[model samples]
Target: MLVVQPRSRTVVVLAAGEGKRMKSDLPKVLHPLLGRTLVGHVLAAASAAAAEQTLVVVGHRAEQVTAHLSEIAPAALPVLQAEQHGTGHAVRLAMAAAPDATGTVVVLNGDVPLLRPETVAELIAAHESAGAAATVLTAEVADPTGLGRIVRDAVGGLERIVEERDASTEQRRIREINAGIYAFDAVRLRDALGKLTTDNDQGEEYLTDAVGLLAAAGAPVGVHVADDVTETLGCNDRVELARLRRLLADRVNEGWMRAGVSILDPATTWIDVTVDVGRDAVIDQNTQLRGATTVGAGASVGPDVTLIDTSVGPAATVLRSHAVRARVGAGASVGPYAYLRPDADLAERAKVGTFVEVKNSQLGAGAKVPHLSYVGDATIGARANIGAATIFVNYDGVRKSRTTVGEAAFVGCDSSLIAPVEIGAGAYVGAGSAVTKDVPPGALAVTRASQRVVEGWVQSRRAGTPAAEAARRAAADGEAAHHHDASGTVPGDTATD
Candidate 1:
């Protein structure tokens, strides 16, 4: 079977709108949706559609937008639309930056992050196949308020597009509205844009007028109705931004689900676009995986976990923990409440148990920091046991130091291993000990004070003639009653006095 390839295309993204309705100082296109900014998502879709070149037109916060684009999509050209005239003016500026070519050019809105790559491909294909001068993406939305309405001829042939302000009562009732996305033959688009005039009610050049111009000039215009209306939704305010974010999150979670990952509750599972989850991984409710995180196969994450830029190996379980830029090897167990900071690495089968926090540390295979411990700037060898309430005191007044525990070493409960220290292999540190110096192999280190006996101290303090005699009589009575009870004698059967 022969697969027809899509024609070479260039994409022009209009991102210059001030978006004053958003009431934010930041440019609307720079607002975040899912993990990437709004324009970032548009650029991603453009890249996915295999555009030969992409140009972004910026005006509001142009410097910030250009800087971010350089970091995320450096290949895209940025053109400045100094005046906020209209969409047509923005596209015209972008077209000037785009190379002169005969292939199709796609115009997209930067705030429409939910637009899919396949839809763009479809529009291009339809434009090329129909040999139309231009193709406009349209949608049948429930409310066409504040949108341009698409008017058709009697035989349902392509006609002109009218903006809402200029539409008649009947045209305003038309449900099919222009979706603010278009594909056009490069030469024809340039010609139509040249003929655009600011004669509309708003005295602004409308891109929709270009479609009318092309139709009037005996050039065939095509209309492609998007299957999902939400795909054409653009964010103009905070509410729409949040709606788009939720939609994008749902799309990401659905993709993971289809890849054999089990998401117990997708509504509460928020995975970013950059996250990857292997097959058979079980992500419980309220788990948020963000920023280049990867979850391996058979791993169990959450009921409440947030992993940022962290890697979890196969079969590892991270329960109710927060990890950032950390690594957990296969079979490792972390949490019911643990924090793993940057540079923390736990080897296979290692355990970082409840209330434990690890930072810039490494725990070898079979190592255990079972509970209530802080292991920072330290290295624990295989089979080393870190008992409850143990702390590696790694920071002095000026700087931080490291503590190292050799293989099979046992750090007793309530012990503090002061930093710039080491414990040799198989060494034992007694409970409640604070060791500031190194311990030799197979040795026992104890720093606690020795036992001290104070004989008859309480008796000497409480002794008095009548009071001490009454206490002695009471003790004798208590002992006699205990002996009677042990012999199964009833209290009432014994003499009271």
Candidate 2:
């Protein structure tokens, strides 16, 4: 589908915050939620928003953040903010990396991970339509304790924004708080960025100072109140991360539940943005579906399972399994503890038992990989009974090989079907066997030595046991007379004969 968006805008992602409250060496933007870094979420949203250019500014752990972002968004331009600076200074560094162009420029905080592309598009549209030099995204907060307040003119237009410490008593009473998100005309934003000075109490260049500068120059400054306050929250510490995590997850989970998917416990269920579950799919508590995972209709996922980049077909049941980049077909049943690695495929009605690990293999329809087995680089045939403790040994250290078990074959317990071998249809592999060669159809492949006994061993070992004592007692009591038959002379007849 062709997505219509303002791709003319250049996005400056402010990711250079030291996040001292986070109390970690890692920049706060690199912190993960679910399985993705906080900055990753914003970058993905920006990409989805169709920004022509996305610039990332890195300060704390500059090289690490740059490397991580390059891996995530290859097209992103990383600008170095070598020293700890204020948001405006960090954004100014990123603007230097932007190419010379006149278009809408949007500023986004990397720590605000839950923003929607449509919301960002709206912010840009407001900035363009108002013909403003700058537009600040603001929202009403119940407790505006640590946030900046948007001070408006008499006509309710954005005059200037005051930081908490710099705000007067009149400004403190204002419920509308600055969300630290802004969009501006490319030229005007640059003009204001150059004029920003470190004249505040902290001697840090405050972007809120630019709102006043633009207004004093007779350039229009617009105030935009965001409809969703939770989306604009910036994480500062672990406590705020936890709070924002709950908020973001609750919103995402609620949308999924409203779309016909059943999330049994919203508080315990975690899902990523790329995950797609079909109607009638039920996600149990503590289940995490991440990274482009798709669950089919009527499928039941775990109370404690994680699936990454996996596809589950209709009517499948996966419990307590960690399936990564795998596929489970319709009617399949996976384990209470199964591990299906990349390239694993379970055909219709296939069973992967507890503690089984299947990788780079295909289990055919009705095939069962029962408890405690590892089937790797193999193809299991239809209706096969893979006995307990059976494994397909497919590796010879350097190179891996394939093992194919034919239809309806029964591999006995504790057997190993070494790779480059096959079990023909209806074959029987004996217990404790290790078949390194092919077994013909309907044949029994017994790979163990025939039974043998050492002579007089039983007599040597049974001399002092309870059975020996009972035998001696019976012999002394005339056991022959004691062996009387039941009321007939059958014993005597047999003995005499």
Candidate 3:
């Protein structure tokens, strides 16, 4: 089959509206939906369309939006609208910013976060195929209130779009509403925009009027109805924004599931669009994978786990943990309640057990930091065991330092390894020890105080207390046992003989 690709063109994104209905200090386009801002999603779609360039028209919070664009899409230029005259005026300013723009110019609204790149490409293909001067994307919605209605000619050809206020009683019943996304012949769009007038009640130049002008001039105006109606929906308020977020979440989760990722409870599993889940990965209930996180194949994450910008290796199991900017190597096991902070790295077969918090540390392959331990600014060698209640004392009053445990080292429970110290290979750190100096290979380090006891102190100091009475009773029982042994009358011994 012979294939044809659409000619390269410039995309104009209108984002200058104040969005009064949204009632937000931030621009509507800057509102976050999934993992990105509303305009960010649109810019992604526009970039995926392979346009020669993209121009964003900014007015409300223009500086903030421009700064965001620099971060998300440095290649796209921002054009200042200066004043909000409406969509037509925004597009006009965008065209002025890109005077050399040619071929098809795709226009998109910044608030439609669910708009897909394939849909934009389809619009362009239909426009080019029909050789139309302009093509408007439309959708057949169940309720079209407050939206521009698409009016068709008697023969079902393109006519014009009528806003709700200007629409007649009969036109009000039309289910097909203009999506406000368009693909136009760049030259013709420029000409039509030049003739737009601020003659309406709002005294603003309307982009819909340009379509009527093109149709009246005998230029073929085309319509491409969107297959997925929800994609055409734009955010106007917090309520609509929430609806869009859910829709986008469903879309993202469904895509991952169909690709062999097992979402055990999709309702409770929130996966960002930027997250990647490998095949055979199981995401359990209440799991949130955000930012650039990636789950390897055969990984099992959650019952309740949130990972941001973290990577889970293949066959790793992360149970009820929160990790940020961390890495779990293959076959690693983390948590029923672990906190893996930034730069925490657990190598293969490593175990970060219950109540362990690791930060800026690395656990070598087969290393285990198990139960109620804080391993920070440290590196544990392969096969090393960090016992329960161990603390890697990495910070002094002035600065932070690191502690290192060599291969096969054993750190006993209740031990604190003071920073700037090391436990060598085959070394043993005794229980209750506070290690301040490095130990040689195969050596034992115990810094706990020497054993000492004061007998009968409890009886003498608290004669009337329960503890004193218990101690006296224990002493009397011991004397009676000694008397019985001296008399060769041990209880239960004669019967056994």
Question: Lowest summed-lDDT stretch of 10 residues in model 3?
Answer: 1-10
- Candidate 2 regions exceeding 4 Å error are 1-7, 395-401, 451-497
**Predicted structure with the largest lDDT when compared to the true one:** 3
For 288-394, candidate 2 gives per-residue lDDT tens digits of 99987999999999989999999999999999999999999999999999999999999999999999999999989999987999899988899998888988898
List pairs with backbone clashes in candidate 2: none
TM-score of decoy 3: 0.95
Ranked by lDDT from best down, the candidates are: 3, 1, 2
Q: By TM-score, is 2 or 3 better?
A: 3
lDDT (Cα, tens digit) per residue for candidate 1, span 128-226: 889989999999999999888999998896689999999999999999988889989999999888989999898888888899999988899999999
Q: lDDT of all the models against the reference?
A: 0.91, 0.86, 0.92
Clashes of each: 0, 0, 0
* Residue 393 accuracy (lDDT) in model 2: 91
- Which runs in model 3 stand beyond 4 Å of their true positions? 1-6, 469-497
> On a 0 to 1 TM-score scale, where does candidate 2 land against the true structure?
0.89
Q: Specify the highest-TM-score model's number.
A: 3
